[model samples]
Target: MTDTTKPRIVITYCTQCQWLLRAGWMAQELLSTFGADIGEVALVPGTGGVFQIDCNDVVIWERQRDDGFPDVKTLKQRVRDQLEPGRDLGHIDRA
Candidate 1:
């Protein structure tokens, strides 16, 4: 069951591309940074070179559309923007 009250981050990566580590790493980063701020971070397997990050069903980062994967700082910013617009991400917000 999912807690719809809080924000959910879904990371869909291409299974054929062997991007599980990448997706998992990103999930870890988000979890570590946001902590309890986010409800969950899900890793969904996909194919055809797909790599997307969705927050609460809103696509925030798409590998094809965004050109490539997002860096940690950018990912953090995007998540923060969606979940808590006014929240500061310390050094991440500085750069």
Candidate 2:
């Protein structure tokens, strides 16, 4: 198997949290934000309050560590920073 240059995003959310909708929504958010610049977005089932976002195996967000779920804009920004540093997230980039 081979990995592409574009980032592959993985969203692992806690089934215990009932976070499938949240994970799926985040996946859709990532896809819409990055468009063709990204390789793929996948959702994985997890437990123990786990809700993490990863790109190319690099962890972007962790719920317990970070303390909570990220806003869609924040998550997109994290992804942009890792996958496409030069990407302009437009209004979403403003801090």
Which candidate should be chosen as best, given TM-score against the real structure? 1
State how far residue 24 of model 1 sits from its true place (Å): 0.4
lDDT of 1 at 19: 98
Tell me which residue pairs clash in candidate 1.
none
What's the TM-score of every candidate structure? 0.94, 0.90
Q: Across residues 1-95, which tens digit of lDDT does each residue of candidate 1 receive?
A: 66667899999999999999999999999999988877889999999999999999999999999999999999999998888899989988883
Give residue 50's error in model 2 in angstroms. Answer: 0.8
lDDT (tens digit, per residue) of candidate 2 on 1-95: 32487778999999998999999999998888787888788899988888999999999999888999999988988988997789788999776
- Residue-level lDDT for 61 in candidate 2: 96
Off by over 4 Å in 1: none
Clashes per candidate, residues 3 or more apart or on different chains: 0, 0
lDDT of each: 0.93, 0.88
Per-candidate alpha-carbon RMSD to the true structure: 1.2, 2.0
TM-score of 1: 0.94
